[model samples]
Target: MYGARLQRSTCTNCNAAYTRRYLKVQRRVTPAVALHSRARQRAARRGLPFDLDVSDVIVPSICPALGVPLVVGEMRSPYSPSLDCIRPALGYVRGNTRVISDQANHLKGVLDIEGLIKRAVASVDQRREDYARLAAYLDRELLLADVRRKAALAGAAGEEWAEVAKFLDAAFVRADWKR
Candidate 1:
């Protein structure tokens, strides 16, 4: 039964019983089978080359791109496992294919390496600008604090006045102020 294929007999009762048993024990589709079928269909529709086999398709526990746990058989979810082509122009070739989360695949859609780099650089530049602004605000607050300290020490005794002068001198030197 394991090695030989099941042949349909001329007995209608046997056929009916087999069909009933098959329907009752509905088998689950494996991830590799589903991914291979989808890749083949997509490659055909897009006129792309496809050489993937069911054995070649392997779903990892976590997405390599997003580092998130891949949820198998959860269609339409962000964390669902998806077969992605590293180079879309190369089609579904064995070396170029990888399993990533659906969200990571969607985020990478149609973008080449140069485009992705440009996006990353833009985000970094924006963050740098924000930090610069924050640093300027902090500098101003520090200067204001120095002024308040100087004002508080103005009513102190002569020796304390000398210390205030030295503090002001150091502050001016730090600020690169002339005289």
Candidate 2:
């Protein structure tokens, strides 16, 4: 029933004396207004300084952090635009505030630039170690396979040589020849 308020109006003309009921349209909450309000409330709750107005909150079409299309009025959506404090300690000041995706804001989670960089570097190092270990395992397996192949070939050659020697000995006995 929001924005459904009715107002009674009377005609000013002398000929008409009838009162008409008109619906008063309520103002829709724009992205800027919503962001400013939410940020103000959060700052108030956290006892942080807030100096942002509705005009100060500029919502971009795409989130600067994630490059995803920002949606308004979708509070629970990850793509919903959120007003983030670049420096939490600085509060919701004009220069400290930015409009980013809710997902990015949540992922950031109070992390400073240095903390984020440290985490990223650690993750990269872990992945590199995992890849190196996998490569070493594969190399060892290939080397073992090569050795097994060579051993089989050598075994086969030895068996063939024994058969040839036996055949020669039998031919020599049949011809009554001594070696």
Query: What lDDT does the true structure give each of the candidates?
Result: 0.61, 0.56
RMSD of 2: 30.7
TM-score of each: 0.53, 0.53
Cα lDDT of model 2 by residue, 46-90, tens digit: 999999878777777665554567777544588888887766787
CA lDDT of 68 in candidate 2?
60
Any runs in candidate 1 off by more than 4 Å, and if so which? 1-29, 123-179
Which pairs of residues collide in model 1?
none
Name the weakest run of 10 consecutive residues (lDDT summed) in model 1. 170-179
TM-score, cand. 2 vs. native = 0.53
So what's the TM-score on candidate 1?
Answer: 0.53
Candidate 1, residues 13-98, lDDT tens digits: the string is 66777765553333124776777888999999999999988887777776655556777654458887788776688899765666
